[model samples]
Target: MTDPSVVHAPAPAPDRIGRLGAGVRGLMQHAEEAAGLAQRPGLLQGLDPRAKVAGAFALILAAVATRSLLVLLALFVLATALAAASQISPARLARQVWIVVLGFTGMIALPALILVPGTPVLSLPFGLAITEQGLRAAAFLTGRSETTATLALALVLTTPWPQVLKALRCLGVPRAAVMILGMTHRYIFVLADLALDLFEARRSRLVGRLSPAEARRLATGIAGALFERALALSSEVHLAMIARGWRGEVHLIDDFRFRPRDGGALVLAAAILAGTVWAGSVWP
Candidate 1:
């Protein structure tokens, strides 16, 4: 009973967790999408990637320098508010990250909230004592993680991958790991482009109507094709690498002149962080 046009036209790709919100899975998706988005022009996008790195560092520094619950809360609120203000898609972003947060993180967080060292033996369902310190500790840990994660996302969203990865290298990340990251990122697109071409070719041809068996066939066929192509690509890459004198090290070009926007990004980041923390102190 499907419409002829609906069955014929290609469906759009599903929105990934990056397109939704910022939970654990969403955070990962957000990281991926934000990397692509960082290339686009946005209010925060034009600043030097270095500035974004510095700002992210500063936010984390600010978070560590304070132990106040109000300060922590301020960080959380600022992160959430800024995310919304960015006009980024919320529901999509939330779907990407929060599910993992809810499932795995909440698993640990929920119980810790109900039990801890030296908690008052309050009457509860499972004879658990909810201590004030326990609550504070859990909130502080979770809030710090959440705030830091958001601030990191802001940096990643604003900064390009090359600058960030390079910065990571300068910050003492192991060379091999960084090199691996470099290679993997370079190849992901090569792989994805291949997949996209195949998908397009399929769509170009008049494909069958969606049936249970057909859907399974489509998925399996796509997977098998990808696997075969991947093997071919690996062999070709190996030959190419052997032909070219590609040593273990891969160099990246990163030489952008600092602009006034870089200075502004740092100042704005500092001002926001300072204000957020100060506001928390006054509120608490």
Candidate 2:
């Protein structure tokens, strides 16, 4: 016996600080979810970290070097297949990459569809015409961007952060650089937690909508507190590490070994990279 005329009132709009805080929280949650995916049994999970890193880098390079649309399409297909094998949802991958890649690149490429000179596909207003060349160029650019993006995300999706840093070190990256990268990643999560706490505290105390001035003042306070907190946390972390007999270097029990499978994976990646280069060269 529900009343047909019943309606719910709209929720009040969040102020700028609230919106920003929500964004921060969402990013933290999303990153944590992505990290969780690495623990799942998937295609790339058991491979040597070095092999995955090498293969992903090779694919990305091939994608960037190719100008042929067909070759680019092939790279995209390869990336998609890898994602599927790794138990990644195709729809989620597309949602994460396309929205950002296409949002900015699409805006840049849209003009080329009309401005680049070639065989006219369609005449437009102001004497501009859509050209076959422009369309092809735009498609190639977008395909390259998307394919590379997919591979990069796939790398993160497949590998844990520590292993990724280890792979980087094995790849001849400077130890200092690797350490900096690791610290940066860890600190990002720390700061995210801090932001979430600040936001939650503010939210709990908030009884009404904030005036613009109040919102601005609160945002400034939050930023200042975050900066101070970061310094304190960093010092505490360093001291704790020292207390635990930790050196400045990272140590992992899993030493990278190029097993037979790792070699096989590298060979397969090389073959695909060769095919991409050959196709792009012959076609273009």
Candidate 3:
């Protein structure tokens, strides 16, 4: 008989820089989003994730349906307002959009689309002559891409993580996805805390620069630690489930209801969408 724990478990990182970098970035983004914010909801947090999601989609659809710069401009303003009301810091919100801004900026730069697909000019000191058509296409593409991204960020900022997950479950989102989210959301912080602790301990113990072998060993140790922690959590959860009631089918608690807020939320979303679309039509 094989040791089930050792056989099936993922191996720890061997001082893996790539995996560690990814983990650290994700950890920082979450910490930055929630840190130093008020404990209670300001106003937007009171709104349901579904409501926020709906509003975001409406904004996106309106922008997508119309190529007018006016519609895209409306989406930009609406998205910024919603993000502000979420109570997260401007820095954090900027972090969310950092990638979008960078990517779009690069795409619009003179050297990108101006250069033909097959042609490569080694020396164009002044840079390629970007055509008017290419510039317009780039602008249009950037606007559409940014509209969707802003919607996603707004939904994330305004909607509490658990409520977002719950809303997804309520909306008949796949059980597998819900389960993964449920488990990950609950334990992500725990893993982050553990990683931080381990890192601090290792740094404190370090003397001189480590050898290549030592670095690999340390990387592997971190991965091993994460794997064990996750597996232990899974076992604990499984045991608790068995203790209460053994069943293959999972159940979601019935907590959501059609309150007056729901209607009000939808009305506000409709009004914003309608007003934006109407305004787009009139803008010369």
* Better by lDDT, candidate 3 or 2: 2
Per-residue error for 38 in candidate 1, Å, reads: 2.4
* Candidate 3 structure quality by residue, lDDT tens digits, 147-227: 667767667656656667767766668867876776776677767766766776676677765677987898789779878
TM-score of each: 0.61, 0.89, 0.65
TM-score ranking of the models: 2, 3, 1
Runs of candidate 2 exceeding 4 Å displacement: 1-9, 15-17, 235-248
Once fitted onto the true fold, the runs of candidate 1 whose alpha carbons sit more than 4 angstroms away are: 1-36, 61-66, 81-93, 169-174, 187-232, 238-254, 260-284
lDDT of 1 at 217: 76
Query: How much does candidate 2 score in TM-score?
Result: 0.89
Each candidate's number of clashing pairs is: 13, 0, 8
Q: Which 10 successive residues of model 2 have the least lDDT summed?
A: 246-255
| CA lDDT, candidate 3, residue 124 | 40
RMSD of 3: 11.7
Backbone clashes in model 3 = 8
RMSD for each model, in Å, please? 7.5, 2.7, 11.7
